[model samples]
Target chain A: MDLERPLPTPITPECRPYWEGAREGKLMITKCRACGKPFMYPRVSCPFCASRDIGWVQASGRGRLFSFEIAHQILNKAFKVKTPVVLAMVELEEGPRLLSNLVGIAPDPKQIRCDMPVEVCFEKLTDEISLPMFRPVGGAR
Target chain B: MSDLARMRELSNAVGIVGVDESDEIGTLPGKSQLTLHVEAITNAARDAGIKVSEIDGVFTAGQHSPATIGEAIGVVPRYVDGTTVGGCSFIIMVGHAMVALYHGLCDVAVVCHGESGRSGVGVSPRRDTALPGQFEFPYGFGGAPTYFGLITTRHMHEYGTTLEQWAQVAVSTRKWAALNPKARNREPLTVKDVLDSRPVVWPFNILNICLVTDAGGAVILTRADRAKDCAKKPVYVRGAGEGSEHVMLTQMRNLTFSEATQRSGAKAFAMAGVKSTDFDHIMLYDAFTSGPPLMLEALGLAKRGEGVHFFAEGRSTPGGKLPINTNGGGLSYTHSGMYGIFPIIEATRQLRGECGARQVPNARMSLVNGMGGMLSAAGTLVLSNEGSR
Candidate 1:
């Protein structure tokens, strides 16, 4: 286990609400008021409509595995995890995709399939930050 | 005039007079990053039979600024472009230079690249507070292989692309590498060898990734009228285009195909008034095994979900119907982090009939596509040996 694992420092002021929501076990994403479209990685403006009239909203935390890769090698020394880390892109039910990890399942290709149903689960990395990860909806179909 | 006609006239106005690499590529601990840049610029200037002071425009990318490179070379260029998108910045610079030259922003433009990828000489520290760091890095998603490998995985899931097909790219590219003495990994490679190689990420063996080496390359461009007085035959710029979709991998419109390549390639083809079938040779940047296939499909050279077959069936090999990556490519050649410049260099040489052993016979026209920042940006150039009108 890498005890020196690096945790995210929320440098962007717009993303502070996201970290705050994660701390509360609530998956948060931004939705544009003008276009009514949701987007990932909260920002001041909407990507779809270029509207600054955007606000944070609680997500369903339900998504499907869009794609994934089982990493046997880690590039960053600060990334502390067991071998064969499952790095994945999850398409949330709210329509925004996220870069996350798949937890509560073995990092094996035979066990994971694209479009598998998943639900977000948070891990408390620090007192202030809880990483929102995903896992098989019902123990790996 | 129509937009396409205007583009054609602008593209034809400029041509590459000289292209060359540094004194030596591959591990050069004795040289700094700036040294590599200066050496490549000097060599290219000499190759064009022009003094370094004669260059009126400068373009470059990487940790160093164009101003810093210009000062080191004692050049006060009138027009300067420091477009640092990623590996493909130099390719886009070619397009930027064409516009600058057509408008008389500068007469002689030189685009330069030099990276100490292997030696760590004067390499800048990566910023961990950027958008990717804030969103993706927290999930242990760092490095190019992890990010790019996902695209291959998604491609496989959607199109039923096989792991063996990806290995075929490595094997076929290595075959070309064996023919070039300058290629770093010239030893024979087989499909089985690629599969047996250690897995860095699922669907990606170590052999599927690009090699890390220290290298630099430069290209000198001037108006078509001035190109005739240069040392070598000018390779005319028939068409050039650049586009970008997103910076973060998660924000990509589609994981299976590169929209960036599609947009840039469409503009290039329109400007050149040429179809995909018009080119005698092609050079698609191969930063990873998946790059060639993905970009091929995006560029319309092959049908959707059928690009991998180009390599799997040996059609892109030395004697294939269409020759691709004749200089071995980033996979087997030296990939110094930013590999865009090397493709431009090789395409120019192939059009000049200067490639000794791997030369494609009677090669007249070629297409070069470069991707920057994990498919975030793309630059395409249609080049020909035939002089501009």
Candidate 2:
């Protein structure tokens, strides 16, 4: 494991809700009240039409592994043991694409395929920090 | 779109005279990026028969950079650029440098990039990790190789593009690299080799990934008139364009191909007044295996799914119809992680009639497509011999 770990931020004014919800093991996606389009990388405004009328809503966190890559790279010293890791882009049940990690799949290449269904799980890192991750759902909900 | 005159007008203003790269590039053990870039710039200047002091502008690429290339090279350039798009940065540098030169911002502009990526410079676990990086590692989107693999798979699903076509890209470039010793994957590779290679990411075998060598390439651009006396023969920048939309694949409207490549290539083709089929040579960027196929589709070389067909028929290999990646490209040649510059280097050599065995005979016009980010940033340049226009 890496000694010099890189931790995420606290639930501050801008990103409080996201961190807090992750701590509660729930997924939240923001939407623009003006446009009703969902978005990831939570921000104060809608990136589509540039409307600031945004609101937070609970997301089912159910999605599919639309596309993914197997990373053999050890990004940090803490991650050396976990070289050849799998990272992915999950298209959420809501709409926006989320940059989240995948879990619960064999590291072997044949274990995954495009458009595979996955569900989100929160992994707590430091105090006040949790990440929304994904894993293949063996069967339906 | 009668930019044919405009392309000529741009060529009349600026031309890229010489291109050079550091021989001992990539993971120089303890060498810093600055030293690599300096050596590359000096080599380029020397190859162009000019002094380092003549350069007045420098452009650097990538966001997580230590400093501007000019400052590190000890030159106080009149123009300093820190255009931070990942791999395709050097390509945009050409377009931006030309614009800067057009208005008389600088003379002797040098576009430079070097990273110890293969040597692994203080590279982080991707800031998005846990947020995305660490969080996704176990589920398979491990690195760029597989990240691109995901995109390639989608392309395959939607367009009927096949794995064999993607393999053709790797095989073709390796054939070129087999001849050029600097290429990392010069060993013979076939479609079967591509199919059987260990899977780094689904749809991408080890051979499909670009070589992560650490090297720096530099190109010197000067006013058209000054280029006459600079070196052997100058390759005019006939047309150039750049496009940017999203930084990550998640944010793009679609993941199959790059809007940047589409937009940039459109503008370049329009400006050059030549269709994609007109180019005698192509130096497409291949950061990952999927970059070219998607880019080829977006750049209008092959229709969406037709890119696979183009490759399947042997249209892009050397001595083939399209004759691409003649300098072995990133797939076969030095990837340095930032493989954008090598395409330009090869294009310049082809224009100057210097690529000995690999030269495309009578090659007059060429096109180079550059990509940055996960196809977030793109630039296309049309180069031709001085009198072609």
Candidate 3:
């Protein structure tokens, strides 16, 4: 097993708030004040309406497994991930999708299904960063 | 005239005069990226029976600028395009060169591509601090296989596309590879062989992915009038189109279908004034086994959810109704990271009846579609040996 430290997310000005919320065990996303639509990966403006009146808001932290792949090969040697890691896209209840890791379950095709309910959980990586991951809604943490 | 009419007038206004690959394609560890570019450019110019000095326009994509390539090749190009939208940049450059030729911006244009995909010679080190690097990479998103596999997984969930159907593409393409001496993997393949291959990602075996090698290719184009004087048969550029959607997979409008493919295919088909049935040969980028089926459906070449049948039923194989990826494709032939130029070269060769064994007999019209990034961009070209009406 490679114990190399995983690459850290380079926090941008627009995404700092989302990372800050993750440290506090809160799921935060941006919603457009003009269009009343929510989006992810924290941006300064709403992608739907091109409005800069977007602001950060707490999300439900609930989502569905939109799509995923169980990777048996790792491209980046710095990533300290086990083989068969479930790399997935989770569609938040707030409507935007997030690229995240699906954990707390066996990485098997028979065990995972699309549209399965999932909820966000944070793992603190350092003093300032926590990654938001998802698992089956009722599965063991 | 309206914009549509003027756009239609540009159809068949330019034709491809020459096309060739680097002297040695499969694995040239000794060759640098720029060396591959120069070799392909020189070979293509020689094939066209023109001096490198006659190339007035230079177009290319990748780490190096067009000016650098033009300078190294001893050409002072008046018009140059450095459209680096990924692998499909070369295919898209064909369209740009056509417009440049039609407007007399340059008389002869050469679009070049050379990548040290496997050798890593003169290759630029990529550092991704962008949106994808910040978000997706942290989740152990392993390069192309995992990125493209997400689409296949979602397609399976949405439309019940099966693993067997995906393997069919690999099996069919290998049959074509067996005929080309230049192909990398020429052994006979079966659906069973594909299914039994090592797993890289769920729903994808090692056979499902494109081979990583080092190669370079170039295509020369000129006005239709000047094409008659070229060394080879002029493969008329009947129509061309290019488009893009999103940089990240999550931002893709729909996981099962590609909006970029549809947009580019529609524009190309419309400009050509032909239906999908008009093509005698077809070549869709096969970065993964699932690429052709998804793109076939998106391009309306096959009915929705039935694109896999084109390969599974052997309709796209040699002697089939619609021969696709006749050069063995990126899967079995050579995928030098960016595979866009190889398809153009194959289509041009097929149209000229130069393909000795794997030739599509009487192949008059051909369609080539290329995908860049992770289904982020697309470029479509409709070529015909017959001149414009």
Each prediction's DockQ?
Answer: 0.75, 0.34, 0.70
Model 3 off-target regions past 4 Å?
A: A1-5
lDDT, residue B98, candidate 2: 85
As a TM-score, model 3 comes out at 0.98
lDDT of 3 by residue, B64-167 (tens): 78999999998799999999888998999999999999999999999999999999999987756667666877788757888898899999998888999999
User: Can you write out model 1's per-residue Cα lDDT over B1-389, one digit (the tens) per residue?
Assistant: 88877887876778999899999999999999999999999999998888899998999998888898889999898999999888989999999999999899999999999999999999987655667677888888878998998898999999999888998888888878888878899998888999999999998999999999999999999999989899999999989989999888889999888999999999999888889889999998998999999999999998878899889545788888788888889999889999999999999999999988899889999999999988989999999989757
What's chain A's TM-score in each predicted model?
A: 0.94, 0.84, 0.92
- Model 1, runs deviating above 4 Å: A1-4, B126-128
- Residue B167 displacement (Å), model 1: 0.9
Looking at model 2, residue B271 earns an lDDT score of 71
Predicted complex 3: CAPRI docking category: medium
For every candidate, what share of the true interface contacts is present? 0.71, 0.36, 0.70
Per-residue lDDT of candidate 2, residues B1-389 (tens digit): 45566554665467888788886754576776666777888899988888888888888775334246666666778888877777778888888888888879998899887777677654443453333332333233335664566677677767777778788888887777776756666777789989998866556778887877778789999877788898668888878888998865677888887888999998887777778889888888987666777888899887787766555445767678777788788777888777788899989998888877777889899999988867888989999885454
Assess the local accuracy of residue B225 in candidate 1 as a C-alpha lDDT between 0 and 100: 90
Q: Candidate 1, fnat value?
A: 0.71
